[model samples]
Structures are given as C-alpha cells and as structure tokens.
Target: MFELAKEFGGIQNPEIVVKLFSLTLMGQVGTSRFAICLKEGKSLYSKISGEYLETDKQTLFKLVSAPLLISELPDTKRYNILHDHLLKEKISALIPLQMQNEVKGVLCLGDKLRGGGYTQSDLEFIFSLSNLAFVSLENARLFNEELEKKKMESELLIAREIQQGLLPRTLPTIDGFEIAAENISSKQVGGDYYDAIPTDNNKFIITIADVSGKGTPASLLMANVQATVHALVPFQLALSIATARINDLIYRNTSSDKFITFFWGSLDAKSKKFQYVNAGHNPPFVMRRDGTIERLSDGGLILGIMKTIVPYQEGSVALNSGDSVILFTDGVSEAMDINGVDYTEERLESFVKGLNGKSASAMLSDIINEIQRYCTAAAQYDDITLIVFKAT
Candidate 1:
C-alpha cells in the first residue's frame, strides 16, 4: 500500500490514475493508457519515468498508432519532446486515452528478449488484464445495486407470507352442503379474510370480512379478530348475540378509526337453514333454483364503527337443492376502471343472474374474471374474496 501511495503521490497525469488503480487492485498493471470523458472532466492517467503521450482528442478515439512508446519512436518527435517535459514533472502520460470500440488505447511495454519491442504475447496479456479490470469495476457497481433490491424484495416476501397466514387455511366441512372460498390480494399485502367455525350443535358458522386498511397492521388486526371469534365460537349463542360480542371485541382491540365490514352466518347443513348478520357489509346473494335472487343484508353498523350504540340485526333463509349463496368483500363492488365507474350492485345482480347456468366453481371464476375485465388497467386497491355455498 505504501509503495503504491508513494508512486501515486509523485504521479500527476490522466493515465496514471488508471495505472495506479489497476496495479493496486489487479496485482501488476503496466502501461498507462486511459481516457473516459465524464461530467467531471476528461480522465487519462499513467505511471512515472514513463513516456507521457498527449493528444487533442476531446473524446475517446481509436489508437491510430499501436505498440509504439513515445520515448523510442522518432516519427512523433513532438511526443518525445513532450514526454521529456512531463517526465521532468513526474507526469505519467502526456497523451490522452482514445478508443472507438475495442483497442481504445495503446501502451508499449519493454520487449521480452531484450528491448526490441513489445511481443504479441505481452500485448495480449496487457489487453486481457485491462478488459478484466474494466469488467470487474462494472460488476461491482451492479452487484451492490442488485443486492439492495433483493433485500427490499426479501422484506416484501416475508410480509406476504405473514399476511397469508392470517387467512383460513382450510374451510370447515359441513354435512349435506358444499362450501368453498377464495381470496386474491393485489401484489402488496391486504385486509381480507374468510373463516369457518362451529357455533353450536348442528351449526356451522361462516364469516367474510374486509378490514378497513392494508399492510401489516390490517393483517395483524385480522389475526387478532380471528382469534377472538374462534375463541368465542365454541360457546353456543344466538346469531345477534354472538355478533354483538364479536363487535365489542373488535372495538376494544382496534382503534376507533379502524373498522371491519363483516358478514357472519350459521348454516344448519341438515336443516338447510341459514341465519346471518350483515354489519354494514356487502349483502350475501342467495340464488334459488327457479332463478330468484335474495339479498341478505340484514345487519346493523359494521364492527368497530361505534363503541356500543348500534345493535347488529339478524336474518334467516332456507336453502334447498340447486340453491347457492355468494358472499364477497367490497373489492368486487368498488372495482372501477379508467372511467371511474364501479361494478355496482345492479351489475353484480345481473352477473349472478347470468351465472345461474354455470356450476359452483365456474360461476365463481366467471364473476371474478368479469370484475377484473371491468377494471382493466386499473390497479386493484383491495383484496378480492369470494365464498360460494351450494346446497347439495
């Protein structure tokens, strides 16, 4: 380090900088030929007791003369005289670096067998070394930038995993009924969930909720709410009473500003009975075999909307064969396009009417696809959730 520092301290030429850097980084770099025009200035540097070649090229130009040292060549006597001048001042190169594509600059090292001229092997070695040096520097810069990007990506992936865990891993099985649900979030983590829990003897509970916000906070709150409901569900209770208690739990746990639009219900698979409460949520649609549509939007204020004032309302319906109920979050209704119009309830009702001909899975897939197409090119701002219940 000290040797290079001393050599560099006495060096003062554009080409000398590259010579010093290459030598320091790559072991032994000889023959200083440099030039890369940057916003700072023209850069060309080299080493000492060496011939300094000066040229008028403002930019990097191809080396017209190859393997000729300024000190030995008599043709460019002006270069020889200039080399003498720069050497007196310890300047490494009086010449600027020039290159068009490859073979940008030239520097003649001493010949192998005496000092006739540089051999082809020596020239090849120098060229290879310089190329390696240039590539190494470029690679280092790119690698660092990529490393930072990967770190950010890692953080996002971890967040996504955690968010995913908050959702129901498996739906609860109920006798004499077919139930299935799915949710897809925009690239970032979101606040949407569905859960199946047993509420009482012969009673299977279903919940589809949309928490008000996104990211880690919403996911965390959803987890908290799920735990609370699951813990309370094991006890047999009336639909309204259970929802009221659940709302209080949520209100107590989260801030007044944060709330969830939730729909909760219990289905008696054997009896074909459905009882549910809609807390300021999208109404669940019941499609009968005769092509009749039933909107179940009976509940009161959404959970976390008030500390204790509003009471939750309850409703019930009977499901026979060929009957299906669709429950979803606001993502489907509020979905809009460049025109800024939503996929309103009327459109959704028409979609349900259209899908009466399709099977359960097909109907679900088609509805989601239709909504996505409606909002073409518009980034989805919320989680899209769908739960379809068919009486088998």
Candidate 2:
C-alpha cells in the first residue's frame, strides 16, 4: 500500500488516478465493482453518465467526514436513505477522500467477492488510499484556479488602458480662461469621465459625466458618450437640443437600469457667457467674485432613463474675472472614512469657498489632498472626478 501511495501521488491526471485506485482497491478487498464521486462546484458527480449523478450529496459528504459504521445503524432513517441511493451494484464500504482536513470526495466499493463484510484493518487501508488520491486532485484544482485568476487580471488591465485613452490628455486652451480636470479611478475601473473640445469660434465645450456601474461595461458606455458629444457639438446645435439628442442616444443604446448623470456647456470667450444644461447630475457650483454661489440645476432627467419627455431647459450665467466653476462627480462629495461617514457636499463647498483666489490647477490638487486626508486608511470605493474652470 505504501508503494502504491507513491505511484498515486505521481499521477498528473486526477481522473485516471481515481480509476486506478478503485481497480487496486477492488483487487485487495475482493469487491465486485468500484466507483468514485467528486465534488464539482455545487454538486457531486460520478461516472453514471456525462451529466452529474443526482443523489443526496450533502448527506453522503457529512457521513464520510465523521465516524460512521453502517452495520451499527440499520434502524436509522438517514442510513437507510444513503444505503438505498448510494450502495447500488452490490457496493459495500464508502471511504472518504480528504485533503487539508476537508473532505474532497468519496470512494465506494462493492461487497467482498468472498461474500463477507470488510475487517477493521481493510477499512483503514481504504482510507489511506483515498487520502493519496485526494492530494493529487487538490493540486490540480489549485493550479486551474490560478490560471483563471491570471486570465481575468489581464483582461481588466486592457480595459483600464482603453478608458484612460478616452480622457483628455491636454485641456483645450480657451482664451481668457484657465481650465483643469482630474480623475482618480478606484482599483476597479470606474465610469467617471470629463472632456473639453475647442470649437470653430473662440467658444469651446466642456463636459463631465458619470455612467452607472463600473469595469468594461461602464467604460464602453463612456466612450459612446464621448463620440456622440464630439459629433453633435460641431453641428452648432443649441445646448438644449444637443442634450436631448444625447439622452435619446443613450436611452436607446443601453438597458433601462443603466443611466448617466451628465453636465455640459458651451463657453464664449469674447462674451464671457456660459450656456449649459445639467441632467440629474450633482449640481456644479459657480462661485462668483462677490462671494455668492450659483448651482446649475435646470436640465431634464438623467440620460438613458427614458427618452426626452420634454425639451431640456438650458441655463446661462456671465462669468467675472475672479469667478470659478467647480464640477465634480459624487465620488468627491460621497467619499467615506474608516467610520463610514461621507465627506459630504457641505465640506466640499466650505473648502472651495475659501480658495477663491487660487489658480484652477492648485485648487484641484488641494481638494484631492483633503479628500485623501479625510478618508485615511479607508479604501476608495468610487471614481473621483473634478473639473475647475476659472475666468482669468
């Protein structure tokens, strides 16, 4: 048995090892037939057919884990059910296959060819053989799991690359204005996005959006939004009309449960007038040089929720020399600390209210630093996106 244990440990194919061990067991115990059942995902499988063999697998599993002598429990209901369902083809002893203190499978053998029950010594030998088979099977399972994990990680890396490429590498320089935007995604790819496009006139368009969900699906939807905005903005469409078109496109393209909170606007360099619409997004704050704050909140429903029911209302504001507009996703306002308290919108407004004199880029950096400080030792759960546009 010790020599056979070494041979079983060397076998690479777990299925082949199981079959070989069963044959060897039948020879030693003089059993008529032998069979092995192994756990696969949520169920147990045997060689009865290509599909799984339907039986009470959980009960059989529990029986093998503890000390059970079938001959001593003839009157028990559980023993009767297990015996009737499992011990077919004249099978007698059922031995447990264990690895790392966990039962991985079961080994069954028919009644002895000598027409008698197995001795105590014979049962112990069967246990040793089952353990040898389990070690080989567990090794194969772990190797396959590692391979699958590596494959998934490689796919996620590719997805992150594509999402990063869609973001602006450089903010389009509009005369008489300073613009800065930043995005810090969580470990899982988040759907936060921002962009700036320079039009034919001195005017340009700026946009910030957050698609629901994350990973490859959200990134793909964001790419679609980018393509749609770039295509329609050049047509000289009004902000309201353009927003309606975007809503229709997203609603038709994705499922009902998926949606995007969006804000976009056109800025006139010569007139210093900003025309915009906010579609169920977190209202952006426009801090005036007079210390008064204006919230942009006049647009229709969120994109992809349903088709445009009514024309999206457009809003406009005139910017002064020292005024700044702050655009952010919920990630900044909803950042959680170790104690699960959100940083909150009030904190963000207070932080920016005192920074009315800083440069656009400096203000962006300081806010991110404050967020990191507040959420110390806690993992970021959502994507953080910020855009600051100041009338210089």
Candidate 3:
C-alpha cells in the first residue's frame, strides 16, 4: 500500500495514474479483466482490458455504496438493470471511488483466475487504491481549468488594448466646430467606435457606429469597419455611394446575424453644409439655435444585412452658429435603472433642450453624469457611446 501511494504521488498526469491503478488492481486481485470508469463533464469515460459495459453516472452512484460482490446486490427491479449489465460484462465486484460521501468513479474487477471469490481484506485494499487514484485525477483536472482561465483573461486584455487604439486619440480641430466623444465598454472589450478624420477642402468626416454583440468578435468587426472607412476616405466618393459600397463589403465578409448601426457625415467648414448617411443607426438630434429639433434619419438599411439592394440616400443639414448635433448608441437610451425601467430617448431630448448654450464637452459630460445618476447601482448591460458636436 505504501509503495502504491508513493507511485501515484509521483505522477502528475491523470491518464498515466489511471492506467497504473488498473494494472495494480489486476495483479493484486489475480484477475485478467478490469475496468475503471470516471465521469468527465457530462459524459462517461471508461478504460477496460476486455469488454466494457456502458453505464451512466446516476446508475453507478445509486447501486454502489461500498465494496461488494456484484451478485450481493438485491435481485429486485431497482438493481436489475445494473446487475444484468455487470453479469454480461463478467464483472464480479464493484468498488466505489468516493470523496466527501460522493461517488466520483467506479472500479470493476472480474473473477479470480483460480475461480475463488475475493475476501474482505482484498476489497478494502482495492477501495483505498481507487480513492488515491481519483484524488490525483481530480487535482489534474482543476489545475488545467485554472490554466485555461488565465489564458483567456490575458487574451481579453490584449483585445481591449487593440480596440481602444482604433478610436480617435484626438478629435480634429475643425474651425467653428466644437466636438467631444466618449465610449465606455460594458466588458473588457466592446463594439462601439467613433472617429474624426480631416479631409480635403476645409472639410472633415465624423463617424460613430455600434456593431452587434460584444467581446472579441464584436471588437474585431468594429476594427474592420474602421479600416474600411479609412481606406475609402482618399477616394472622396459621394456620401451615398460610399455608404453602399461599405454595406456590400460588410455583408459579404460577416455572417447574416452580424451587422452595424452606422452614422457618418462630411462637414464643410466654409459652406456649413453637412452631407450625411444614417445606416439604420440611432438618428442624431440636430438642435437648432432655438428649441426646435430635427432627426437625421434619411438613409437605407443597416450594414451587413445583405448586399445593398436600395442605394443609400444622402441627408443634408445646414448647421448655423449655436446649433448642435447629438449622436449616441442605444446603450445610452436603453440604460436601465434599478427598477428595470429604461432611460428612453424622450428623456434625453428633454435634457438636451435645457443645454442649448453649453459647450460640446460640457454637454457630453453632463449627459453621461445624468445617465450614471439614473442608473444608480445597477450594472451596465451594454456599451455606452456618445458624440456631441456644436457649431460655434
């Protein structure tokens, strides 16, 4: 027994321990046939020298409480199924591998080669051996699980860094325009993206998008959208035509279930003309100098649903001094309170009406603060993003 314990303790691999345990039991009990069964995840795993019987964990747990001959089980309806199976497989004895009064596995042994039944001492020793092996196997499984968890956490950190790098580091300083944007991920990585790029002829582009889903997959797709937008900027295509091409590219590359709610506009500082496309995104509120608000919603379907069947239509808005455009993802509008009630778009519009003369940065900060106050201690369930640009 001491030698067997020493041997098991020396091995770190569970598979090797199981094999050695089976061989030791066969040699010690003078049997040619043996089987070791262990539970792995939702399935049964068995190692046998000869034929094996397929039995579930529930059946084994209910039948085997201690070491005993298979024939000793009551010949009733309750034990009939397991009894018949053991008999057919030539298994004569059952030893349970238990820890903390719970059965973790079972050891089955065939008849002695000399045709004699196993004594009580032999059964006791087999039970002890089986438990020792089970402890080693469980330890190995737990170690592997911990290692996998650490690996996933490390990968997520890298993904978060990459996702953040794709966002604009500094908002372009367009003359007569004050712009401020912020994104807060609900997890280590998210799908929300925003950017401001300088273009030709005293003009610049402002873009914001919310890709479906979250985590690594969503972040990767967000990166793809950013890349596509940057690559097409030099072409200077019409807003409507450029939007259609982007939709087709996203549809061909991503699955049908994946799509992005996108809003982008080219603002000309000299003309004060904003030509934009709203691809099924939340319509940005164009609050004029007065209290009146206009929603920019004229465009085609969201990107990646299918090839652009209908050409994207452009929407033009003339921004005057003191006018502001507020754009946001649904995360902000659908943010839930502790009572599960959403802070809807109506509340946002009412709040904006009170901030007619505030700077872009102040407006953005105040809106985020209001949302945080409304949500209170409730956990954020999605990414929150906002972009506020004012014509100064």
Which model scores highest in lDDT?
3
lDDT of 3 by residue, 34-87 (tens): 666655542223434333354444677667889989879887898787777787
User: What is the lDDT for 270 in model 1?
Assistant: 78
Q: 1 or 3, which is superior by lDDT? A: 3
Model 3 CA deviation exceeding 4 Å by range: 1-14, 30-40, 47-56, 74-77, 105-115, 289-292, 334-357, 373-381
Tell me the whole-model lDDT of each prediction, alpha carbons only: 0.67, 0.81, 0.85
Pairs of colliding residues, candidate 3: none
lDDT of 2 by residue, 232-295 (tens): 9879899999999999999998999899999999999888999999999999999988767889
As a whole number from 0 to 100, the lDDT of residue 267 in candidate 2 is: 91
Kindly list the per-residue Cα lDDT of model 1 for residues 1-392, writing each as its tens digit. Answer: 34544554454442454555555433443333333322123333333222233432311133223433334434465445544544453332212223344444433232222224344564445545444444343344456668878886675576567657867798877777777788888665667878877655778888888888766777777777777778777776777887888788888878888998889898998799999998888998999988899999898888886665666778999999889999988888888887888888889988898877466777888888998899899888777899987887
**Best first by TM-score, ranked:** 3, 2, 1
lDDT of prediction 1: 0.67
Top TM-score hit: 3
The model with the greater lDDT, 2 or 3, is 3
